[model samples]
Target chain A: MRKTFITAILLVLAAFTARAQTQEPEMADALRANGKIYVVVTVLATIFAGIIIFLVRLDRKMTKIEKNN
Target chain B: MRTWWWKILCILLVGYTVIAGFLIPVPRLDILNETIRNLYFHVPMWFTMIALFTASGIYAIKYLRSGRLQDDIYSAHYAITGIAFSVYGMLTGMEWAKFTWGEAWSNDPKQLGSAMCMLIYFAYLVLRNGLKDEEKRAKISAVYNIFAYALMIPLIFILPRMVDSLHPGNGGNPAFKQYDLDSNMRLVFYPAVTGWMLLGFWMATLRIRLHLYRFKKENSFAFENN
Candidate 1:
């Protein structure tokens, strides 16, 4: 158990070191760099619109059963 | 008899989940990059898990008030579903953490809190299993569910933010505040939360219907035999 605990600590240290060494890429900046995230956002919006259509039905069914005995 | 609107809606939701779940490329992040998009699955699983347990708690209370077996059955079904989602959530979170947090395990407040929440529900199941009488089982499980639900809030939300966190959004790490998070991600994220929640309920409802049917069948058979 002691060995396992020590290993866990060492591993966490390794991750911090890696993050410090590597220049992290910011997604917002990258999307701004490429200028495509807005379009991607629009696509995601349309997909969720489809999901709402499906869920409303299920909600109505649940309400119906709850209403009846 | 004819509720075309819901039918139409369900088709759209399924199509959206499938398309958004797979089609859109995950956005890039600094620390985790596009890999973080797995939040779409990982986060929602816990959200649904919470909703299921909250919902079960309500039914368990109702059973105590009304002496209805059906309410107890509903509680059981939802508790089971919550456990299933918790398993999926923990697995996905572990995978996400390994890649992003740089390790497979940590005692970080968020990590520990989530684990605690899973244990509370697992205990709820154990309470039910230990009882032989149906009435006793409902009473015992209902009491357990109430306490479990009460404990879950502080464990998942309040405590995690109180201390150091290896997880983003904690540990003074300047994670996404509501406004800082991408509006585009919210577009998929909010619907994803709702969609999975409804689907979780759909699973519970199917189980409830099957239970009701079996109950009725047994009663009819008893009557005929008598």
Candidate 2:
């Protein structure tokens, strides 16, 4: 089972890397050079992280309440 | 609905969307060169918002028929989460517009329609706050929710189509998919929509459970006093 799982993972990685090599150049070289693209990525990541943190906090509150009850 | 597998799927799908959306090569067009990639992130926000609001409307209908407080809780949380998604949608759209379109806030028909749709929901929240009685709050808000959602569909989807607009898929402007959604783009786009919808639902469920816990605690407190 472990060997097959590893093989499957390797196959998927190989497929992706092969596709990557054959891929056309991306259109956002200017955005990438200016570092604006990373800005967008950072903003998106931060928002997602903030939301997940909020959910985790809410979950903790509920756990406390359940314990008291 | 609250299965672990689906939540895991949401995480993986969204992770894929973020990675592929930035990295993948898209069909380079004239105006929307790289910003065309915004299709994956910005467009899915609208789809997820609509889906969540639809769920809210269903819960509202259930509340009316069942007269259950739990139903109202579900209805309210879904609407709240939907509103959050709508805000994110509008913000991302404005940011994307700043690049593609001249300004962030063009008085486009779709923009106007989006504003109206959001205002209607804001009115719903304001209406809820104004009422002090719980039973009256649930019943009236349920009716209003159904009415607001009914209006929301036409305001966002139908009305914009009738007029000349800056937004794509309406007016003279060409849609992103008109150039063919490119199987490559579809790979990220479909998963993005599904992932965001699932994430929105997950947040709504968390809020609903939190509200339920508070409601139960209050009930128990009252029982103890009695």
Candidate 3:
């Protein structure tokens, strides 16, 4: 009886693991695994930072013009 | 208007959005796949546009109440900035749709409504520019702006919900909130909207300041003679 109980518990655990694997839809696991996604993230962040810097400079120029006015 | 804190916050929030938006774990769905991350970038454009347009409408009311050209300048610049954001929203939405929806221009109810909304605002600009007299232009456009804003509410918000739309949150389609926009996404989504709205406001303020400078320059001689 104890052997049968152990076998049932092991079977249930195996089914849960198999379902977890098959149920998951495809994601960027390959890109993430190879770590190339970080490259894209870095490029985007850099471009955004550049835009922010440009805006700040423009804001300062506007302030200077306003002061002279 | 020149406060630095919110600008700084905008930078921080948007920067965080870019990083966390890409890194965060999203729901593993079949069709959406990785494009679910577009939620952080795409939806915020519309939110920012709406916020800017709302500001434009408020400034229009203020202009009518005070008969101040400065308020008119504020109104026009806010509308212009809002339109710019809308262009971005449309472009990004189309790009996302092309991949996921199998085509870009599917004549979706939401798309048609937004297109019509843009055309109405464009006509408002044309109407303003056609009047050479400054006072008349400001007053007429201010009234038109109020009407345009009133029309926008139903076209973009109400009509889309009333009809069947391929866009989520409308028709029989389940909204992102029903499934995809879980707590993990909300943390990034709300901040993304706030950051983009702040950035749009900053751009509008800069344009308003430039317009004010020109107005002062032109009127300076009159003041000096007095």
- The candidate that wins on lDDT is 3
Residue-level lDDT tens digits of model 3 in B1-226? 3688999999999999999999888888878899999999999999998999999999999999999999999999999999999899999999999988999999999999999999999998899889999999999999999999999999898999998998988878888999889999999999998998989998989999999999988899789999
DockQ of each: 0.15, 0.14, 0.58
Q: Pick the candidate with the highest DockQ.
A: 3
Write the number of the candidate with greater lDDT, choosing between 1 and 3: 3
The window of 10 residues in a row where model 2 chain B has the poorest summed lDDT is B1-10
After TM-score superposition, what is the CA distance of residue B226 in candidate 1 from its true location, in Å?
5.8
Q: Pick the candidate with the highest TM-score.
A: 3
Better of 1 and 3 by DockQ: 3
lDDT string, candidate 1, B141-212, tens digits: 888889999999999878887888977676675665443357666666677777677667766765676576
Per-residue error for B223 in candidate 1, Å, reads 4.9
What share of the reference contacts survives in each candidate?
0.31, 0.23, 0.77
Model 2 lDDT tens row, B1-117: 224577668777887788778867677666677788889888988998899899999999999999989899999999999999999999999998898888999999999999999
Instruction: Sort the predicted structures by lDDT, highest score first.
Output: 3, 2, 1
The runs of at least 3 residues in candidate 3 whose Cα sits more than 4 Å from the true structure, single-residue gaps closed, are A1-23
**Cα lDDT of model 2 by residue, A1-69, tens digit:** 999999999999999989976664457788877877878777777777677667657656766776677
Position B225, candidate 1: lDDT: 100
